[model samples]
Target: MSELDAAVAAALSADGHLADLLPGYAPRPEQQEMAAAVADVINQEETLVVEAGTGTGKTLAYLLPALLAGRRTIISTGTRTLQDQLFHRDLPLARQAVNRPVRTALLKGRGNYLCLYRMERTLESGRLENRALADGLQQVRAWSGRTRSGDLAEAPAAASEPALVPRITSTADNCLGQECPLYSECFLMEARRRAQEAEVVVINHHLLMADWALREGGFGEVLPQADVYILDEAHQLPETAARFFGLSVSSRQLFDLARDIRLEQQREAGDAPGLSEQAARLERATADLRLVLGDGMRTAWRTLERPVGEAAEALAHALAEGIAALAPQAPRGKGLESCHRRANSLYQDLQRFLAEPDEGGQVGWVETRGQGFYLRLTPLDVSEQMAGQRARHGRAWVLTSATLAVDGQFGHFLERLGLDDARTLALDSPFDYPNHALLYLPASLPEPSHPDFAEAYLQEAQTVLEASRGRAFLLFTSHRALQTAADWLARRGHHQLLVQGAAPQQQLLDRFREAGDAVLLGTQSFWEGVDVRGPALSCVMIDRLPFGSPADPVLQARMEWMREQGRNPFATYQLPEAVIGLRQGVGRLIRDASDRGVLMLGDVRLVQRGYGRQFLHSLPPMPLTRDPAQVRAFFADQSSTSS
Candidate 1:
C-alpha cells in the first residue's frame, strides 16, 4: 500500500485517529475497508461505486480521505436532512478526528436561504394572507437582521411555515443579481462564494444536479473545480438527474409571473393599461389550462386526448400574446425589464414543453397537483447524459449508499449511472443480521391483485404486530392500501395506529418513537430514511413488492421505450427497482448490531414466484420463516436473550 493508503487504514483502525478522538467510538472492518477503497479512489483519481451498508460509517470513510488529500471535495446527499447532518455533525467529528482545519460550507438550494430583497418586497406589498404568515415574516425579518448565513433552517418561525419559504427566497427566474440593491449582502451569493473557497462543500442532490446541468451562473460553476465528488444516498442520482435534464412549466409559475408583471407595471409602467389587461388574460389562460388538465390526472403528453391537447396549445398561444404585449415596455426600468424577461422565458418554456417530442428516449407528461398543472419532459434514460457530464468534469467520483446494489452486484446501479468502468465495493453491514433479525415471508396469502388480498395482508400484519407487541411499521406500496389498512386497524383497535399524513412525517416519527410500541402505517416515504432503533420498532410489515405503478406516466413511458428496444422491461428496469426499494424497507429492521426485529413480507409471490430468490438474495442475510409461530418464537427468543 502507498503511504496515503496506509495512513487512511491506520485512521480507520480500532485504536487509530478516529477512535482516539471520537467518544464511544468502536472500529469496524467494514468501515476500514470502505475507507481504504475511498482513499484509493482519491489517490488514483478514478471513479468508485461502493455499497457500504448501514452502520459502515460511510460518511466518515469518504470525508477522511477527502480531508487527508487536502483536495476540493464536493459531497452531495439525497436529502437536506442528511446534508445538514453531514455539515453540522459528521464533518465536524471527522475534522476533529483528522486534526485538520478543512474549510467546509453547506449550500442548499436558494429557497433555503433568506433573500433580503424578496422578504422586504413581500412585507411591503402587504400581501400577507394570514396572521400566521405575517408573524412568520416578522420572525424572518428579525432573523435576517442577525443571521450571518441567512439560512431559513436557523429561523424557527420560518421553519414552522414551509409554504412561506418560497415567498421569501429568490429563485433563478426572479433574482435581480447585481442590479439589485441588496446584492452586496445577498445570502445565496455569499453562500456560493464561501463554497467556492472551501476545501469541502456539502450540498443536496438537487443543487448538485443543477450544478451539473449548468442551470445558473457563478453558483452553477462550483462542481467543475472540485477534485473529488462524493455522493451519499447515491441511489437517488438517476431520478434527480432525469428531473434536472428535463423541461417543466407549471401553472403556479405562470400565476407568479403574471403577479410579478402587474407589480412591475405599477412600478415602471405607471398604470400601464394594456399590460394589466394582458396580465389578467394570462392568469385566466393559466386557470383555463389548469381546468383542462383537471385534478389528480397524470398522463403522457403524446397520449393526451385531443380536447386536452388543444386546450394546452391554446393556453400556449395566450402566453405568447401576453409576452408580446409586455415586450415593448421592457426599456422602462429594471423592474419592468425583469418582468418582460421572465414572461418571455415562461412563454418559450411552455412552447418547448408542448412541442418537444419524446424521440424514443424522452418521456413527455402532464401532471396536476391541487389547482395547478405542470407539463414535463423527462429523459427516459439519463445514463448517456450523465456519462457525458462525468467525462467532461474528469474528477474522482465516489458514490456510496446502503442500498445501491442488488444481490451483491453493482451492475444495475453502474449501468444506470453510466459508470461501467468504475471500481466497485460491497461492504456487508457490521450488524449481526442473521442472529438479530428474522425474515418472515408469510405463506398462503392471496396475490396482491386479489379482491381478498387486502384483508389477508392485514390479517398477517396484525399477527406479526401481535407477536411483536404492536411495535411495527406497516409499509404499503400505495396510499390507497395504506389508508385501507389504517382504517381496518383503527376499527379493530388492535394497536396504537399512527397513519401517514395525519401530521408531518417528522411529527409522525416522533410520535411513533414516543409511543414505544405503536404501529405506524405509511407508504413509500416510510420505506427509507426512517431510523427507529431498539425494541420500539420490533417488526416491519411490507404489503407487497414496491413495483413502480404501470399507470404512472413516467414509468409507462420508460417501460414502453424499453419494450420498443426489445428489452425485457421487467428484468431490465422494474425488478431491479423493486429489489432496491425492498432492501430499503427491510433495512429499517436492523439498525444496530444489538437491534433485533422481524421483517414480515406479506407478498406470497416471494415463495410462489421464480423471481423470489432475487428479492431474498438482495436482502441482508437472515433466517427465513413462513409460519407465524416462528415469528412468535423469534420474538420470544429475543425477549429471553435480552432478559
Candidate 2:
C-alpha cells in the first residue's frame, strides 16, 4: 500500500472509544472502497454522488478522509439526531483512531440559540415572566457567565420542559444584531466565532440552505472556506432547500412582535410614538386571518380553503397597501423592524403570485404555521438553479444515502439536483437480508384510493400486530389515515396503543419500549430515523406508499416544472420519490446484523402495479411473501431457531 493507504489502514486497525471501532468490526470491502472513492474526490476537488447502503458505515467513510485530507470541510445531515451523533460520538472517535490534530465544531441555526435580546424581550412580556420561568431564565443568565460555546444545547437545563424552549430560543431574523447592549457576550455570535476556526463544521440542511439564502449570511463568512461538503441523508435536500429558497411571513409572528413592542416600551421607559397603533394594526391583521381561515385545522388539501380566484386577488392588493402603509409607521426596535421586513416580503410575494399564473411562473399558496405564515413562489425548475450553485462553489460535494436511486438508476435524483456530469457510485450492504427480513404484501387489499382501503388495511394490520404481538409501528401516509388506524386499534383495546399527538414523541417511544408488546402508530415523521432495536420493534406495517399529495400546491408546481422540461413527472419524479420514502420506512425494521422483522406494505400496488418492482428492487434483499401463513411460519422458524 502507498503511504496514505497504509496510514488509513493503521487507523482502521487502531483501538478507540467503542470496542466496535476496529478492523474485526471494520467496514466491509465495499464500504472501504467507498471511503477510498470519497478520498479520491476530496483530493481531486470533484463532485461525487455515492449511494452507500444502510450498513455501509458512510459516516466513518467520509470522516476518516475528511480528516486525512486536512481540508476545512462541512458535513450536513438531514436530522439533528445524526448531527449530534457525528459531533459527540463518531467524529471524536475518528480523531482518536487517526490520532490527528483535527479541530471540529458543531454549529446549528441561530434559532437553536437563545438570543439574549429576544429572551429579554420575552421575559418582559408575561410569556416567560412567571417565577418558575424567571428561575429558568436566571439559570441561563448564570450559564452565560461560563459558557464558551454559545450553543443553547450546551446551556444547562435544570428541567426538560417544552415550555422553557421558546423562552430561551431566538432566530436570526428576530435577533437585534450588534446594536443590543448584550451583543458583545451573545451566545449566537460566540458560537459563530468558534466555528470560524474549526476544521470540520457540522451543520444541518436547513442551516446550510439558510446560509445560501443570505439569511444567516454572516456566519457563512465566519466558517473556514471549505474544499468539500458531505451531505448525509441527502434525500431531504430538495424539499429543505426549496423551503429556505422561498419567502415567508405570518400574522402570528407580527402579533408576537406587537406584544413584544408593548413590553419593550414599558421596560425601556421610552415615549415611542406610533408604537401602540402599529401593535393594534398587527392585531387587526391577525384577527382578519383567523376569521377568514375559520376553525379548520386539518393538513389535508380538501379541508383547506385559500381565498383565491378574485377574493385572493383583492386580499393580496389590500395586504400590499396595508404593509406599505404600516412600514413607515412601524417602531424602530429590532422586533418591529423584523416584523415589518417580513410583512413587506410576504406582501410582495403574495402580489407576485396574484399577478402571475403557473403557465411559466411558479404557482403555490400561503399558509400560517406556528409563529409565521409562508408565501412560497417556487420556481418551475430548480435543477438549473441547484446545478449553478454546485458549479459556482469550488468544493467537492458528496451526497450519500441508502435511497438516492430507484431501480439502480440515479437519473431521477441527479436530474432533480442538476448533477448531470457528477461521478456516481453505489455500495451494497454486507448483511444477509434474505435471512433477516420478510416482505409481506397482503394480496387482497384494495387500492390506496378506495374508500374502504384504510379500514381494510387496519383490519389486516391487526392480524400482523397479533402475530408479532404489537411490537410494530403502523405508519400511515396521512394524518387522517393514522388517526383512523389509531382509533380502530384503540377500539380493539387488546394491546397498548400510543398515538402520535396523544403525547410527546419521546414519551410515546418510551411507552412503546417499556410496554414491550405495544403498537405506536404515527405518520411521515416516524418513517425514518426511528431506531427501536430488538423485540420492541419486530414488524413495520405501512398503510400505503408515501406519495406527495397531488393537491399540494408545491407538488403540483413541481410536476408542472417536470412536464415543462419534457419529462413525465409521475415516472421521473413522483415514483422515484415514493420508492425512496418506502425504503426509508421499511429500513426502520432490522437495524442490525442479528435483527429480524417483518415489513408489511399494506399498499396492494406493490404486488398489483407494474411499477411495484422498482420499490422491491430498492429495498434490502429480503424474502418476498404473499402468503400470510408463510409469514407466520417464518416468524415461528426464527423463534424456534433462537430458542
Candidate 3:
C-alpha cells in the first residue's frame, strides 16, 4: 500500500487510535478495505461510486481517508440526522483518532436557520393569523437571543409550529444578501460560508445540488470549491439534482414576494402607495391561479385552463409594476433595494417558467401541494446536466450509499448520474444477515395489479404482524394503498394502528417505540431512512414493488427517449429502479447486527416474474422462505431466544 493508504489502514486497525477513541470498536476488514479504497480514489482524483451496506460503518471508512488525506473536502448526506451525527459526533471522533485539525462546518437548507431580518420584520408587522403562530413567534424571539448558531431545530417553538418556519426563514430568492442590516450577523451566511476558514464542510444533498444548480445556471456556486466531495446516501442525489436543475415558480414564492414587498413598502417606501397596490394585485393573481389549478394530482401545464395563463400574466404584470414602484424608492433603504432586486429576479423566472418549450429535454407540469401550487419544468434526463456538474466542479467525487446498486451492478446509478466511466465497488454488508433475519415471500397472493391485491396484501401483513406480536412496518408503494390499509385496520381495530398521516412522523415513531407493538403504516417516505432496531420492529411488510408511476410525466418522457434509442423501458428503467427501491425497503428491516426481523414480500411478482431475481440478488443475504410455517417457526425461535 502507498503511504496514505497505509496511514488510513493503520488508523482503522485493531490497535489503532480508532479503537481507543470509539467504544466497542474493533477491527473490521470491510471498513479498512473501504478506507483504503477511499484514500486511493482521493489520491487519484477520480470518481468512485461505492455501496457499503447498512452495518459496514461507511461513514468512518470515508472520514478517516478524508481527514488523513488533508484535502479540502465537502461531505454531503441525504438526511439531517446523518449530517448532524457526522458533524457533531462521528467526524469529531475520526478527527481525534487521525489527529488531524480538519476545520469542519455543517450547512443545512435555508429553513434550518432563523433569518434575523425576517424575524424582526415579522415581529414589527404583528401579522399572526392565530394564537399558535403568535406564541411561536415570541418563542423564536426569545430563543434567537440565546442561540449562537441560529438553527431553528434548537428552538422548541419552531418544532411545535412548523408553519411558522417559512415566515421567519429566507430562501435564495428572498434573502437580502449583503445589503441586509443583519448580514454580518446572518446565521445562514455563517453556516453556508466558503473555503478559507473551513477545510471540510458537511451539508445535506439539497444544498449540494442547489450549489451545483447555481453553478450550472452561471450564477456562481453557493459552496466553495474543494479538493474532494463525498456524498453519503448518494442514491438520493439524482432526483434532488433533477428538481434543482429545473425551473420552479410556485404560489408560495409569489405570495412571499408580495408579502415582503408590502412589508418593505410599509418600512422603506411608506410614501409609495403604488407599491402596496401592486403587492395586493400580485397576491390576488397568485390566489386566482391556485384556484384555477385546483387541487388534484400533478397536471400537464398545457392542459390547464387558459385563465391559468391569464392569472400568471397578471402576476407577472403586478411584479413588473412593483419593480417600477421600487426602482424610485430603491435609494431610500436596503429593504427597498432588496425588494426591487427580488421582484426583477422572480419576474424573469416566471416568464421563463411560462415560456419553457414543452417539446425539449424538459417536461412542464404543475402540482398543487396543500395550500400552494407549483409550476415546474423538470429535465427529462438529468444525466447531461449532471455531466455538466462533473465537468465544472472537476474534483475527486465519492458517492456512497446503501442502495446505489441493483443486482450487484452500478449501471442504473452510473447512467442516472452520467458517470459511466467512473469506478464502481459493491461491498458486502458486515452484518450476519442469515442468522439475524429472514425474507418471507408468501405463497399464492394476487399480483399488485389485481383488484384483490390490497386485501390479500393486508391479510399477509396482518399474519406477519401477529407472528411478530404487532411490531412491524406496513410499507406500501402508494398512498392510496396505505390509506386503504389504514381504513381496513381501523375497521378491524384489533392491533394498535399508527397510521402515517394521523400524526407527525417523529410523534408516530415515538408512539410506535412506546407502544412496543404498534404497526406503523406508511408510504414512500417511510420506506427509507427509518431505523427501528430491537424487538420493537420485528416485521416489515411491503405491499408491492416500488415501480415508478407509468403515469408520471417525467417517467413517460424518459421512457419515450429510451424507446427512441431502441431500449425496453421496463427492462432498462423501471425494473432497475424498482429493484433498488425494494433493496431500500428491505434494508429497513435489519438495522443492526443484533436486530432480527422478518421481511414479508406481498407482491407475488417476485416468484412469478422473470425480473424477480434482480431484486432478490440485490438484497442482503437473508434466508428466503416460501412456507408460512417456516416464517412462524422463525419468529417463534426469536421469541424463545429473547425470553
Candidate 4:
C-alpha cells in the first residue's frame, strides 16, 4: 500500500492514532471505508462523490486523511452551525489525534462580520430611531473595540436582532474597500488573510459559490488555490450554484441604494444639486412599482408585459435619470465616489433586468412577498457552469453527504452536478436501524388533496403521539398544512404543543427538549439538521410526501424545460428530490446507536402511488408496519429496555 493509504488505515484501526488519542473512541468499519476512499482521492488527485450515512463519523474520516496528507484543503458546509463545529470542535480534535500542527481558519460571508466604518457612520448619523436600537448600537460599539475577529456572532447585542446586523455590515455595493478609514483593521480582510495562509480553510456553501464563481467583486479572491476541496453537505451545492449563476434585482436593493446616496450627499456635498430630489424620486418610484405588483403575486416574465410593463418602465426611467444627475458630482471623498459608482451599477442592473430576454436555458419571473418585490433570471441548469469551474480549477474534489443518493444510485446527483465520470461510494450507517427504529405507514388515509385529509392525518397522529407520549416532531410540507395541524392539536389539548412560528427555531427546540413530552409542528426548516437523541424525541411524524409545489415558478419552469427535452420530469427531477428530503427527515431519528424511536409517515401515497417503492428503498433498513398496535408495542419495548 502507498504511504497515504497506510496512514489512513492506521488512523482508522481499532488501536490507531485516534483510538490512542481520544478516550472512549470505538472503531467503525464504515468510517474506515470512507477514510480510505478520501485518502485515495488525495493520492490520485481525482474527483470523488460519497454518500456516508449518519453516524458514520464522516467528518473525522475526511479530516484525518487531509491532515495526514498535509494538503491545503478547503472544507465547505451547508450551514453556519456545521461550519463553526468543524472549525472549532472537530478540526481541533482531529488535529490533536493525528498529531499534526496544521494551521486552520474559519471564514464566513461579509454579513457575519462587523464593519467599523458602517457602524460608526450609522451611529454618528443618528439613523437609529428607537431607544432599543440605540442601546443595541452602543453595546455593539463597546463590543467592537475588543473583538479580535470582529465577527458579529461574537457580539451578543448585535446578533440578537436581525435588522441591526445589516445596518452595521458593509455589502459589496456600498463598501469603500481600502479607501475607508477603518480599512487597516477590516474584519473581513483579516479573515481572508488568515484563510489564504491556513492549510485548512472552512467556509459555508454560499461563500464557496461566491468565491468559486467570482460572484461578488468587493470580496476579491477569498479562496486560495488548494489541492483538495471537501464539501460536507454536498447535496446543497447544485441549488446554491444555480442561485449564484443567476441574476437578481429587488425593489429593496434600489431603496437601499437611494438611501445611501442621500446619506453620502449629506455627508460629503452639503445639499448637492438635484441629487436629493432625484434620490427621493427613485425611492418613490420603487415603492410605486411595489404597490402596482401587489402582494403574494408571482408572475412569469412573459405574462408580466401587460399588467406591470408601464410601472416597470417608469421605475427604470427614474433610475436612469438619477444616475445621470449623479454622474457629474465632484469626487468629494471615497464614500461619495462609492455612492456615485453604486448609482451607476444600480442603473445598469435595472436596464438589464428590464430588457433581459428569458431565453437560452434561463427562466425569468417576478415575485412579491409582503412588501418586497424581486425580479430574477435564473438558469434552468447550472451543471455546465459547475463542470467548467471544476475543470478550470483542476483540483481534487471530494463531495460527501448522508442523503445524496436515491435507491443506492448516484445517477441523479451525478447528472445534476455534471460529474458523470467521478468516483462514487455509498457507505451505510453503522447504527442498527431495524433493531432500534420502526417505520409506521399508517393505513386508510384520504388523498393529500382531499379536503378532509388534514383531519384524518391528525386523528392518526394523535394515536401515535399517545403511544409515544407526545415526544414527536410533526413535520409538514406546506405552511397551510402546518397551521391546520397546529390548530387542531391546540383544540385537542392532549399535549403541550410548540408551533413553528411561535418562537425562534432554536428557542423552540430548546423548549421541546426541556418539556420532554411536547409535540413540535414545523415545516421545511425542521426537516433536517436536527439532533434530539434519546427519549426527548421518540417519534418523527411526516405529514406527506415532500414534493415541490408545481405552482412554484422556478420548479414549473424547470419541469417544462425537462419535458421539452423529452425527459421524464417526475422520475428525473421530482421523485429524486422528494426521496432525498424524506431521507433527511427520517435520519433525524435514530441519531446514535443507543438511540431508539418511531417514524410515522402519514402519507398513504407511499404505498398507494407507483413511485413509492423508490422512497421506501432509499430509507434506512427499519422494520416496517401498518398497525397502530405495533407502534405502541415497539415504544413499550423501548421503555422497558431503557429501564
Worst 10-residue lDDT window for candidate 4 reads: 213-222
Q: List lDDT for all candidates, in order.
A: 0.85, 0.73, 0.85, 0.86
Local error of candidate 3 at residue 448 (angstroms): 1.5
**Model 2 lDDT per residue over 1-643, tens place:** 5455555555554343223555456436776778788887876788899998777888888888788877789999988778988899989988876776998889888767766676666556655646787787778767766767656666766323455665566555455677677888787777777788888999988877777767233444434457788999988888887676655544545555556545554554256545555556656665565455544232322234565334444545544554554466456455556556655655665566555534454555655544344444555556776787677665788999877889899988897788898899989776678888898998888999999887788778877877787788888888888887777877888658889989868789988989988888889889887878877888998888888888677777677767877979898878998998998898788777777889999888887889988988888889888888888887787678778
TM-score of each: 0.97, 0.89, 0.96, 0.97
Using lDDT as the measure, the top candidate is 4
**Residue ranges of candidate 3 with Cα displaced over 4 Å:** 159-162, 193-195
| 474-550 per-residue lDDT for model 3 (tens digits) | 89888888889999888887568999888888789899989988889998888888888888998998888899987
Which of the two, 2 or 4, has more lDDT? 4
Candidate 3: the clashing residue pairs are none
Candidate 1: which stretches are off by over 4 Å?
158-163, 215-224
Candidate 4 Cα deviation (angstroms), residue 477: 0.8
Q: Per-residue lDDT for 1-643 in model 1, tens only?
A: 9877887877787788787876887788788888888899888989999998888989888988888888888899989888998899999988887877989999998888888988887777777679888888888888788999988878875555856766788777788888988999999989999998898999999998887776332344644377888999999899999998888888877887787777778767875778888888888888887877777988888887787877877778877877788778888877678777887888788787777757648878888987888889898898898888777764799998999887888888999879988999999888888888888887878989899999988888877877788989999899899989888989998657899999888889898989988999989888888889888898988999999988898999888888988999999899999999999888888887778998988888888899988998988889999888999999899788878
The sequence of per-residue lDDT tens digits that candidate 4 reaches over residues 125-185 is: 8987688888898999888889999987679654567557667888878888889899998
What is the descending TM-score order?
4, 1, 3, 2
